[model samples]
Target: MTTTVETIRKGRKFDQVLEGARQVFMADGFEGASVDDIARAANVSKATLYSYFPDKRFLFMEVATTECQRQSRDALDSIDMEAEPREVLLQTGQHFLRFITSKFGQQIFRICVAESDRFPELGQKFYSSGPAVFRAEMAAYFEQAEARGQLHIEDRILAVDQFGELCKADVWPRLMFGMTKVVTTAEIDRVVEGAVETFMARYGV
Candidate 1:
């Protein structure tokens, strides 16, 4: 599958190589993907690929990191910080968790999980670029909610992290293991509703 990384902004050739590498890596796990494969997919010479990315690992890191950022923006950018806490949280939770449970999301997570040990930087990159970005956005949202007297958040960062995990509590684990694949609107609503209820119980004004 073609990895969607619309948020990645780099030199044309550089992004081209990354896009190629992302497709190859997704199709053929990290260990299976080769520089030649990426070069061929990108229509650049091996030398050109290496010039942009010193090594296959670095290329993979960039693709994975960009993927994280892309997914974060895909879901988080639409959040209305000025909205009510319940509306914002519920909306964000629904979109975020739904994206996480998607095929593309599952593939990226698997890539990180599988190659993280061989390349520990992958985990750090994934976190710093993806989840951390989301957490920061959520924290800002929570801060706004607190300012509006809609939520009681003494630690906005921590509270948002909790809220993020709460959204994943019921759905995301099953996703990682391949136990569940299909996602209906009913399932998303159930998960988001539960998370919203629990979060409001603890932090509601």
Candidate 2:
């Protein structure tokens, strides 16, 4: 009986437990979210919860990974990848900023950071699933755009990273540092537009 991530996902109550954990984690964060509370939230006994996830860290990682995959899929799907570079970057920037400034996004980041010292793997897993995967997807798009003569990116990886940072500029930091609690649509648009402009200034053909 190998109770790995794959096996855990196959459990009948996997989604239920994941949802319950996500709710609790969002509310209380990793350090504060107790197993007892998670089980109660899922309407399952502690034993049942453990049966699906032997460790709390595993559960948290699963929640973060699953959410990241879903977010990436949804965001990419909504964007017209075949559009002009400016339009594509604009849409991608908007989606990126919107998510990173979101409550769930912030929570996921905080959990990874807060638990990093004790469990380095937590941060690693989050980065791999979230940022790393995202960067790769962006790079693939940039390469295609370059081939189409829509952009001229000598270093796709660096360009992708820069674009991400540009999107984060003010909104992401303010939210992360408690400088602002709310981000209006105007703010998202402003930042995303700036990101696209800067990115295109360097890469647009």
Candidate 3:
């Protein structure tokens, strides 16, 4: 029987290993990261690390997926669900813009794309944990807003997707295309506020 990565048993040091992997992956690209370095960084033996993760790809995928999930969850937690549609959307758009334009997020995206041919699962994991998670959260919020008559949306999912695309208008493409290295606060604010305004104009009640 083949041992799947998911079947690996996570001991008490599971979180410790994940934290260590995240640090190393951030400092070094996926191809540059080594198991020995990961083990040393995690303060775990090679045996222990192997016990938890059979392969380096699996470890990297878990780290990326976990970080994406945490980012979305943290952003959702900070949002005021009861706030007016414009206020809530502004907050959400800001969070989305800042995170996607961050160094870690960019690295994860690049790594997933670069390694996709060899490891298609990495990209799938990233999408499910990042974009899909964000869409689901935003969809729920849109449903709530519609219920309160703050938004008139015939398709909540489509609106959620549109809002995401709107938030990515300028800054995200610039960063992705290597036209800009640093995402200024001003840029984030510009894109986020524009997205909110566009969304509210279309959907606000």
Q: At residue 8, give the lDDT of candidate 3.
A: 62
Clashes by residue pair, model 2: none
Candidate 1 residue lDDT tens string, 65-168? 88778877877667676878888889888888877787656666776677666666666767888888888888877777778888887888888878878988
Please, what are the lDDT tens digits per residue for candidate 2 over residues 1-205? 5344445544788788989998898788777899999999999999999998887877988888878888888988899888889898888888888887877777778877877776677778778877788789889999999999999988999999999999999888888888999899999999899888888888898
- Please write out the lDDT profile of model 3 over residues 5-51, one tens digit for every residue: 44768899999999999989888867778999999999999999998
Candidate 3 residue spans exceeding 4 A from truth: 1-12, 27-34
Task: Evaluate all candidate structures by whole-model CA lDDT and list the values in order.
Answer: 0.78, 0.85, 0.85
Any runs in candidate 2 off by more than 4 Å, and if so which? Answer: 1-10, 23-37, 54-57
Listed per model in order, the count of residue pairs whose N, CA or C atoms clash below 3 Å is 0, 0, 0
Winner by TM-score between candidate 2 and candidate 1: 2
> In candidate 3, which residue pairs get closer than 3 Å at backbone N, Cα or C atoms, i.e. clash?
none
Q: Per-prediction RMSD in angstroms? A: 5.6, 3.3, 2.4
Candidate 3 C-alpha error for residue 19, in Å: 1.5
Candidate order by lDDT, decreasing, is 3, 2, 1
